[model samples]
Target: MRTLHIITGLGIGGAEQQLRLMLRHLPTSSSVVTLTNPGPVARGIEADGVPVIHLGMAGNRDLGALPRLTRLVRQGRYDLVHTHLYRACLYGRIAARLAGVRPVIATEHSLGDAQIEGRPLTSGARALYLAGERLGTSTVAVSPSVARRLEEWGVRRSRIHVVPNGIEVARFAFDPAARRAAREQLGLAPDAFVVGGVGRLAVGKRFDRLVRAVAALPDARLLLVGEGDQREELLRTAGECGAADRVLLSGRCEDPPPAGAAPDTLTLPSLLAAMDVFVSTSPDEAFGLAVVEALAAGLPVLYVACPAVDDLPPGSAPGARRIGPSVPELTAALREVRRAGGARLPQPAAVRRYDIAAGARQLMSLYENAVHGTPLPHEVSCS
Candidate 1:
């Protein structure tokens, strides 16, 4: 079945990266439409040869975009329309309905109790989301916790599908050569202890807490991937913690996405291999895709927010430490992980469970079922 995927913007984050990765694996014809700014990830998607249409909506309240999107949806003649993020969900759902598309599905990539649609929920935001939600045929929650959050937010329980975010596990596999190369590229010493984290450097991620934690570790250096509005603030916070010299703030790690039949991916794994331990300081996360990528890279982890790891069976995240959202806790975890070190990167069972190959197949099957008006595959319960 032909599918059209719509997202709010094409930037470097879990949702954007996940879309590119999923496209590499799914065995169906698909195209992408970004509602606003077509940034580097848009280039990556185009490099991968998937047609990307940029709907030049000036801002969130561009009501003119609705009819334009509706016209595009009608002309695409797609069997299914899939939406992601908040604005796309709202606009795409309406456009899909306007185009007479029957099975409009949305993927809820980054919903947390702490925020809604990348903004703190104001007086009537939840009410607005619920109204937008009703136009979709179904919604895909990235984790069980996100599913629960959606239920609490008044999304009908019957319309939610739990499909965790996944990664190309083999691509993230640890490599000794990669470790050395990445270290050399980043000017890291041959034997220096490193702690790394990857995500948008937003306030909610609590990266400031990481700067504080690193201040307590004299020898352990920090490598943070992803960029955001908090870059300047985080630089100042690192300075305040006296860890400015030891921190490396690498902006968005853009790797070429796959196109056509040749899906040669980029090398975020190499950077991951250079790190001794991975940490997540997010206050709350829906599925925590970066942590999974770290696990696939075989990095021992210390995390404050990862439902994807915590919800797994006991002993899943073996040798990984779980710490609270405090400076002292993170400091101790970093020190301990550094002290008890080597590349003893123990990948959790959860890593295997969220492999992108499996997830892509499941999603493709779900799309087929949606178009045919059948239930989701027996493996995934639609309700």
Candidate 2:
């Protein structure tokens, strides 16, 4: 079936990368429409042979883009419309309706109790979200935690589907060669202990805590992936803590690199390979996708909060440990891990639990249900 996927921007965030990965496995005719910045992920999607259209949406209040979007939807005559992120959901749903396309589905990729998409959750934002939510046929939550948050927000239980965010598990399998190569590229010594975190370098991610924690250890090197406005602040924090030389901020590393990619290309999986341990200091997380990826790489994970792991049954992720949010707690954990040495753990069941192909099938089922007017199923447990 022909489907149109709309998102706020095609940047190097979890939702954007997840969209590209899911499209690789989904067995259907699909195209993408980005309402704003068509960044690196957009190029990656195009390289995957999918057509990507940039709507050139100037801003949130640019109402003129609505007719243009509606016109495009009408012209495409897509069987279903899937929206991701906040701005896309608000506009795509209305555009799909205006074009007489009844099947519209939206995925709530980042929704925390106090924040949505790294921004403070305001009452007005929630009101707008709920209003737009009504126009869609169903809303998919990336984790059981996000599903619970939606329920708490007064969305009908019947309308929410729990489809956790997934990863290309095999791509993240630990590789000795990759580890050596990535470390060489990053100028890290082979025996140097590395502490890694992957996410937008934002305040909500609490990467400052990670920097301070790693700084407390003179030998531990910090390799952070992804970029944001907080880059300067993080570097400043490293300088203040006298760990500036040890911190490496590798900006926006894409994974599952394009076919015929350069041998020296620094993708996410390669970065994960170079790391000794993975840490997620974010006090609140919608799904903790990076933690799952780290688990796939057989890296022991220390996280402050991860609904993806927390919601799972015990022993699902043996290598993943929950730690306190404070910098001292993170510092102590790193010390313990360093003393233990950098041995890759056995690939955990959590990796298999969130494979991208399985998630694609689940999403396809949702699409079929929406297109055929079948009753969308209620939320189910991830395990």
The models' CA-based lDDT, in order, is 0.84, 0.92
- 1-383, model 1: which lDDT tens digit per residue? 78899999988777887888788788878899999888878887888778999999999899999999999999999999999998999999999999999889899987887786467866487887899999987889988889998998899888888888888777887788878877887889989888898888888889888988887888889899888999999889888888899999877777433333233222588778888888999878888888888888888888887889877788887855678999999998787777777655656688899998888877876787788866667666653
lDDT, model 2: 0.92
User: Where does the lowest 10-residue lDDT sum fall in candidate 2?
Assistant: 374-383
Worst 10 residues of 1 by lDDT: 257-266
TM-score of each: 0.95, 0.97
Instruction: Give the per-residue Cα lDDT of candidate 2 at 276.
Output: 94
Q: What stretches of model 1 exceed 4 Å from their correct place? A: 256-266
* Model 1, residue 221: C-alpha shift (Å): 0.8
Candidate with top TM-score is 2
